[model samples]
Every structure is written in C-alpha cells, then in structure tokens.
Target: MQIVSTLRGLMLGLGISLAGAAAPAQAEMLDLEKDELKFGFIKLTDMAPLAIAYEKGYFEDEGLFVTLEPQANWKVLLDGVITGQLDGAHMLAGQPLAATIGFGTQAHIITPFSMDLNGNGITVSNEVWEMMKSHIPHENGKPVHPIKADALKPVIEKFRAEGKPFNMGMVFPVSTHNYELRYWLAAGGIHPGFYSEDNITGQIQAEALLSVTPPPQMPATLEAGTISGYCVGEPWNQQAVFKGIGVPVITDFEIWKNNPEKVFGITKEFADQYPNTTLAITKALIRAAKWLDENDNANRREAVEILARSQYVGADAEVIANSMTGTFEYEKGDKRAVPDFNVFYRYYATYPYLSDAVWYLTQMRRWGQITEHKSDDWYLDVAREVYRPDIYLEAARLVVEDGNAAEADFPWESDGFRAPQREFIDGITFDGRQPNAYLELFPIGLKGSQKIAQNAVVGG
Candidate 1:
C-alpha cells in the first residue's frame, strides 16, 4: 500500500470543475437506472482505471456509487459478471467473445470500453534464460530487445530430447497472454499446442506445454520450477525480475505493437436494460484513462502510488512503476524506454473497436477454441454484437464536451475497423475484415474448417 499525500490530494480534485460541464453533454447519466454498482477486477496493474475512477470520485461525479472487488481469477470474474453478481468486471479481451460464442460459458456479454493495451510480457525462469542467452543476438553487451521466441526453440528442443515436459503458464484459456504467447512461439517455428472440442488441454502437438496460472502466482510458480516460463500482465512480470526468479524476454508490445489486451465487460442484458448506467460507467472509465496518459504520462507516478493501495493492485509501487510509467525492466536492471508498454487512453485504446473484437475471434479460431469454420460475415456479426462502439462514442462525446478529452482523441467516424495491422513479431498482417484469410496466414495452427480429430489435425 503506497498511496502518498500528494496522490491523495490529486485524487480528490481530479477535473472537479469540469464535472458540471460534463454532466450536460449527453444521455450518459440520467436520473440513473442504477446508482449502486459492484465491479470486479483481477489485481493487475492495468486495473488502475477502475481504482482511479473510484479514488478520484469519477464514478460518484457521474452519479454512481461503485464498489471495486478483486476477483479470484478470470473464470470467477466472468461468472460474477454473467450471473449478475457483479455489474461488470475487468476482463480478458477474449472472455466476452469466448463466453458469447459458447466456447466456455454461454452468455451475451458486451463491452463498451476496451480497458488497456500491451500490458503483458513473456517471462522465462533463470535456467531457461541462461539457455537462451547464447542464441539471442546482443548489441553492446545488452541482449537485443524484442527477443523472439526463435531464441527459445533450441531450449525447447533440448527439453524434448531429454523427455522433460517444458511447461509454461498463461493466465487463462482465452487470455491475450495465451494468444500472444502462442503467436510468439509459432512465429519462431515452435508449435505452441492447440485446443480441440474433445481435448481441451491445448497441448496437442506442443513443443512446449502452456497452461493456466493466475497472474499473481506466476513469479512464485516460476520460482518453484513448476513452470519454466509464463506470459502474463504486470506487475507480475516485473515481480519475477525483482524477485530474481525469471527474466522477461519480450513484452506483448514487441510481440504485436499496441495490441488490444483487456476490456471492461458487462452482460448485454444489463446494457439493454440499463443503457444509461452503461454510458455512465464508460464515461468515468474514459476520464480515468485520459488522466492516466495525459501530458506524456505525467500523472503516472501518482497513479502508481494509488494502485499500490492495499485493496487495489497491492504490489509495491516500485514494481508497478517499472512498466506502468513508460519503461520496462527485462533482465533485472536491463531496463529500456517502452513508453506505450501499458497504454490506457492513447491510440483510441478505450474504444471497443470492432476490429479488436474480430482479431480476438481470429485467435480463437486459429487455435481451435472455435471448433468450426465460419464466414467473414459471421466474424463481423459477432464483432457488432459484442463490441458496442456506438455506446463508447456516446460516452466519449460527453467526455469531450465536458472539457476532459479532446474531439480528436477518439475515432469518431470509424466503421469499426482498423487498417491492416502489420506490427506482429512474425511480420504477418492482420486485417480484421479478412479473418479466414488471417487464419490461412498461420503456419502451425488450425485453418479453414480444420478440426482436431482423434488427437490430431484432420481437415484443412
């Protein structure tokens, strides 16, 4: 718990004068359908927006009284949201998509807000790090950054020859970590396993086995040697470096620049029934995000202290600041400037872009979480159903009018897609509109009606 006096004062008065102006902007906050709400989040640094909204009284200013609870894991958090036990929760970008498609749990979950971007990293234990050091290229005595998983292929091969299972961990079955880790490994010619309808271990044809381990437990699990590596969000990756157990080899930012990571999810039933409440929540979150990235992240120090509160992230302020405040520590003390490592508001981050939704669906399909092949229109339809950018713009309009955000800060006229993205570490371009085409681009995963039949890939 590291909240300081200056941070407390800053939290109390954040954009107070603008609250009056913001109130008149739109239909976001009405005579409120529901004012008392409970939201759940995992204790990761990206959950800062939720904490900031509560501490800065942003939710209260929007005529909402909110309770923020930390959940046990991704499943429990999603269950709470689906069961109406929670109004909403911080979620993996794929949870709403996966749950809605009946991949895991069947629910009509929707997100008006995409939380933060590129807040995750892939960490390798010291033993694994030592194994990879010789294979990685170096510049001026420091290992070259954006270290590809190609460097780890030999290490996995060694484990394979020795008949040892090279275990790795990810936060969830549908987490961005799972996808990002898979993407990195596959790009380097290492098979990262697959998911099948009958066999859901996702270790089919894996060179290195990946399974779920909660983010907070990652450092300890790596230290105990149960998992040789993991892909997870901050400050857990930073925790590994600080505890001297592991070294983060690559961040999601390098794996895929500015990748969409997490979202703020609520059931579609909740949104339709209480549209105004959804708008209000979105607005408070938008304001909090702006505060986070404004003025070149000038407020990040204050945010770090606030997130270190006992009930919030609960990690040391120093560890959280490692990635949250414009830099990331890889091998302990081998820090580098990674300004967008934990993007919150910038780059239209909060918008629930349909392209972002489509991208998640592609990963689900590529890995066989989606058991059948569907048309591009099906992907587009799901994107439209799950991502509500229309509602996000309504909230953004209020933020802009309230003197908090600029008009140019949002993608006001986007047709729910981004241009073909080509920043992946594999150098593969992803166009959200061409999902099947995206699947075909993969070298080592299910594609085009492919199914895992009898523990093997059957169709193409």
Candidate 2:
C-alpha cells in the first residue's frame, strides 16, 4: 500500500483546511491496530466514497494506508471480506444483514458506515419502453416522471397472454435493486415473484422473473433480448440511455425517497480484533461522504472525473456526470434536476441506522428469504448486531474533534431509527419498530406466520 508521506502538506496542496472554527483545541490521532488495508467494491458510482477517500487523502489523514480494488460482483466482494482477502468492501445494504442472519454466506458481517442513497434505476429495453410508453401519462410531448409500474403491468400481461415469460435483472437476490424493483412491480399489481425453501430460484409464482446480472453487464444483457428490463446502479442505467438501447422509467428515489443503498462492510472479527482501525476506516469514509455532498455538490464534477478513471467506475465522465451532477437523463434528452439523486452524506446518510438494517430484513422475510416469520425484536436485535451505530457515532465525534467536520453534522441523538417512512411507491408505511405489522400491510408478500411451501404460499 502507498502511504501519503505528509497528509497536512497534501491537504494544503489541495487548498482545503484541516481544521475548522468549531474544531477542538487539540486534534488527536488514533493508534491503529492495522494501518495497511485493501478494500473491494463493485464498479458502481455509489462506490464514490471509497474512491474519494483514497484520492483525497482522507485515509492518510488518519495515518492509514489504503487500496481500493473493484471486485467482479457482490458475492466475490463479500467472500473477499469473509475470507480476510479484503479488509472491507463497499457492500449492498442487505449483504451484511443477510450474512449475519445466515441467509446466504453465514458470517458475522457488520457495517459502520452507510455509503450512499438513491443511485439506482429501473430501465426497460426499447421495445418494452415503446409498449409501456402509451400507458404512461404524458405532458408536453414527454412521458411524465416517476412512471409507475402500472404502465409495465399491462406490458407483462401482454407477454403472459402470448405465453412468453417476462424477465428482468437485478444485481443480486438480496440487493436493493431486487427489492426496489419488486416493490415497484408489486405496487403496480404485478407479481414480481417469491422465494421459498424448496425453491431458491425466487421465480415461483411470478409475473416477471428477476435474475442476477452484474452491474456492468446489464446494458449488454438487455440489448441481447435476454431480459426486457433491469434495475441497477448508475453509470450502467445511464449507459443504457447513452447506448440508445433502453429507457430508464424511474429511479429508486421515485420508488422510495432517500432510501439507504450501500454500506461499508467489515467482518465482526475484524472490528473486534482492530477496534481503532475500524474507527479510523469509518472516520475516513464519513469525511469522504461529506466531501461528496458538501457545498451543494459543487465537488461532484471533480468526483465524476475521479470515478471515471480506469480503476474506478471506468465509465465516461459525461455518463457519470449525468447523475452525479444532480441531473438525471431518463429518456435520452429528458434530463431533469434530481439534486438528491445520489446523496452521500446529507440527511445523515453515512450513519448506519438500525432502521435501515431492519428494512432489509423485512424485505427478506417478505420474499421468503428468511423462510419463516421473526419477531420484531428479532429484527431489531439482528440490526443492532450488524449495524453498529456506536462505532459510527464514535467516528463522527472524532471527525468533529479533528475539526474536519462540524458537531452539528452528525446525528448525535438518533436512537438508530428514523421516523416512519411513508414515501414508498405503494404508499405503504414502514416503521422499523414494527417489522411484522409493516409486512402485513404488503398485499403481495409473505407476512405473519406465512411461509412458502410446494410452490404455494401456505400457513398464513
């Protein structure tokens, strides 16, 4: 790992102050148990925090040496962290929760920092878009924004009537893309499918079959006519528009406003073994997230350039800027100002809220990934185990003490839960404190004592 020799000199050259007026009288350095670390990530724009931390010397500011490597996919990245091949990785918000609950890979993964929010979109192939366009409301010769999946329901029905199965893509089974796409489809009265202990395929009783496609492969896969549409993170969704093969119908922000997306995940053993190192990593990530959202996103243009490099997201700067700069182009020329499209720090985004973890667990149970009902307290317990707000607050306090951030920037009194969120596309309310009751409101998912059996939902 390459260590920056003089972090103060680097900051000075960058023309940024290391201290603020509210900074403590003395800045303290942590005694890191581990300084040299390599982290992994997928090639998505939401990985910007990791890139910025390394490029802007945030890691060095904490006397740490770091390397960021892009992994092939979410599984490889998770496996890397579990096997100790990587210290940590940019992870799907669901990855750590699923891992901790022994869903996919049984490991005690914990997240100290949430990466970013609302950077994903659901896009359809040109043919499907043309079919759904007429169903969507229009104004001034353009499709209205937040095109509901109701428009796609008829299209899927048409496919079903013709004895053709509609297929869609998501990055992983436990990904936010899957849940968001499922949420959108079900809200529109389209059955996205379900998972069962007997059927891990998740396509049992489906209207649209959802499958996994790596982020970078989504556009090409759509173009190949393999899947009619997909839900994935930026530059890929924008890549489809740039390639003129598909049209993004709605962003995840429209599906659920300011939703928690990715996280900075490390193993529980790693945190226990190197407590200060974990705190340092979280501090650096918090700083990077703040930089990404600071000054009303004045730095996004620079962030786009950094993310466009070969080692980062590796997409064209223009493609990345389409969303990173706060305006998202949905249908080619239909660019709209979506300033909060990719929130990294604002609205307490970096804080690993326990409610965020509970939300994912609710989705897992709703879709049969949990295989059975769990108590609401069980959900909160798992969240408390995996989503470490204590570590996040400690890191935030240190960042404020260093004078790099203001004390007001962190949510000092949060009880690890946000107020009940009511912005879901279905207009359903989700209270993290009442996971089971929340699940009961969803019309198309497993709830209560319900479980999937023999390709049918049974025992409600």
Candidate 3:
C-alpha cells in the first residue's frame, strides 16, 4: 500500500514537471505610455508591418493596445501625427527629413525604423508604353529587367517636339516615388529638372513634367490619360498591370537596390516623452518585420490576406500578393518571380541607418527641394536628427534581451553602413558620406550651390 501510494506521488510530480517544460516562456511585460493608441497608414502593401503587428498580437505582446486607422492621404497622415490626432504613422521615407528641413510642413518628425524596401514601380500609360517599348532593348523576346528611362527619353522628346508637355505623377513632392522617377529619368540622360527657392514646390524647370498624384488615384489618373506614367507603391502599380491599361516599366529596386521606402514616423516630442512606449512599438514592428521575411517570405501569402482587410491596405488579395508574394507583373500576363520585390526584415531593412536618411537628403538637394547649398556635415546633422539610431538600438536590444531575436540581427560595430552602394539601375554608386561627390556624379541635377534660373519657375 505504501509503495503504491509513493508510485502515484512520483507520477504526479513527473506530470507537473512535463507541463512546466512544455509551457512557453512569458515575454516581459512592457509599460506603455499610451495604451489606447491611434496609428495611421496609407493603402499600400508596405504598410504590412503595422497590420501584422496589430493582427498577430505583437503589439499586445508588448502590452500595447493599438487602433489602426486608414488616412485619406499622405499629407493628412503626416498632419495627423504632427497634431497629435494620431500617435504615429507609416510615413514616406522622406517625410521626416522633409518635415525637419521645413520642406512642406515644419515639424520635428523622426523615424527609428524603415518600413520596407523595393515596394514601388514606375507605370506608364498604354500609349506611352507603346511608344517607349520600341526604344527598349529586348532579350529573348522579353523586356529587360531594370528597364532604364532611356527608352522613354525619346518619347518625352517627341512630345516636346509636338508642343505638348510630358506629365508624370508621383504620390507627393517629398515621396520616394518622386525622387525615383527623377533619378531614373536623370540616369537615362533625360533631364527631369530642378526645383529651388524660385520653384519651391519642385514643379518647375520640368522636362518630363512631373507632378503629385495620390497612390490610389494613380491608376485612374493614368487610365484617364491625364498623365502618361506614374511612380508609386503597390498595389497601384500592380493595379495598372491587372487593368491592362498600363505597364510597370521598372521597380524602385532597379532604380536603387534595396532602397529605403517608408518609415515608422513619430514626433520627437512624443518619442522623448514616451521612450518606453516608443521602444515597445518598435519591438512589435520588429516582430512583424521578421514574420514578413522569415522562412524566405513564406508568410507573405498570409500577410496579403491580412492587408486585404478593409482596415489595412483594403485591396484585393491577388493585387497585394502579385508583388508581396515574390512576383511582379510588368505587363499583363508577364508575371515573373522577383523574390526581393518587397523586403521587410532581411538586409536589416528595419534598421534606420543614418546613411539612408542622407540619401533622401541628397535627392532633396539634387531636385532643389533643399534650396540652400549645405555642407556634408549639415546633411549628416539633419539625418542624425531625423533618423534616431539611439531609439532603434534600444528597441533592438530589448528584442535581443527578451530572446525573441539574436545579436546577429544588427551591425554591432560600424559607422551606420555608409559604404558606397553600387547596384543602381543607372550603375551609379552613392556614398552617403560624400554627398557633394555623389551629387556631382549625376549630370542632370543641381550640384554644389547650383540654383534654378528665374525663367524655370512656372507658377511661382
């Protein structure tokens, strides 16, 4: 009887031990400054990190209860963050820089994490595509990847000769789309022109006639034949391919490899006041980024489903998946695998490198959004102010300490990855540390102290 009783006790103890071993470690409870959080995003696939963080309970995991709202447009979203109507937002890669530099709205917006990469494409209307196609070199009966704007140069010149303006659309003046469109054009020896104090809005001195059109409105504007082509993020670009009304000539990835796209933006005041909350949000976003890129992007299909929900990108699953799930359609029925088309986690995409900030600043200067000729130090100072690596390091450290990620995730010893990147479609290498030298490389843009002429200002 005693032995049987002892045996029963031993079995019970073993069972308890097994149960304890099977349980997952409890994540550290983060103290959030604001629990009822309002976040904003545009209807784009790159906004997936925010959606995944919310839907996957990553924010909740960090003790944050967030409400995601879709904003009317980029300006509204930026204004929302600035006015405290929204706590933070998924912002254009250039927003923080522009805001800090007083380009559009003057505020101290900063980004600690880059949202995603390679999510934009340049789409041409059918008429423009038809004309440009003849000039594009073909290989094996397919248009070459990283198709340069050289093909479209003749088309623009033809329009010029016919006494008609060649207009193109970008989401906003400070958007990556605008700079990329200009970059591609300049690289192909087509002058996309400059903007200065004389042309503060950057619409003047135009050769290709670039202007702002919202992302959702891009396809419709193109379909209406109001614009010949556009540079915007997906699924608008993919929408063009699906509608068979336009063709995506090139991706921003081709414009510049793994280029910085969007950022998780918040005012510096908010971040300074709620340091813990800021880190917590960053932690959640880091998890979302990992999920997006883990297992060689095995989760992208699932991500597309979440983004398809009305609260998020609000686009069709197929439309989001066309680019998000490792494939892109240049023309209708010309879908090809482009695995790195939308990177979230890999290549340290989440890391807010100072150089990434400087690159955008360089574009601002090149196109005359930055009117004054600032030194390399001025550019670096602005970049460092807007791109807070301190906050990023804190968030990354917390993730590592929590064992959710490893030390191998970030650059432990470096000066912020400022190496000369040489994989652009134009084959131009950009060394962010050397802004003047980099600017001088481009023949079509303003270099050191170069200003636009009075005649260049259209409506100013």
Best by lDDT: 2
In candidate 1, position 240 carries an lDDT of 92
Error of 3 at 445 (Å): 0.9
Tell me the spans in candidate 3 whose CA falls farther than 4 Å from its real position.
1-24, 456-460
Candidate 2's C-alpha runs over 4 A off are 1-26
Best of the two (2, 3) by lDDT: 2
TM-score attained by model 3? 0.92
Q: Give one clash count per candidate, in the order shown.
A: 0, 0, 0
Candidate 1 vs 3: which has more TM-score:
1
Q: Over the stretch 1-460, how does candidate 1's per-residue lDDT look in tens digits?
A: 2222233234447844333432354444455688778899999999988988888878876777777888999999999999999999999999999999999899999999999989999999999999999999999999998899889999999998998999999999999999999999999999998888998999988888999999999999999999999999999999999899999999999989999899999999999999888888999999999899999999999999998887888999999999999999999879999999999999999988999999989888888888889999999999999999999998889878777788999999899899999999989999999999998988888889888877788875
TM-score of 2: 0.95
The candidate that achieves the highest TM-score relative to the unseen native structure = 2
- Pairs in clash, predicted candidate 1: none
- After TM-score superposition, the amount by which residue 298's alpha carbon in candidate 3 deviates from its true location, in angstroms, is 0.9
lDDT of 3 by residue, 98-155 (tens): 9998988999999988898889999999999899888888888888777888899899
Q: lDDT rank, highest first?
A: 2, 1, 3
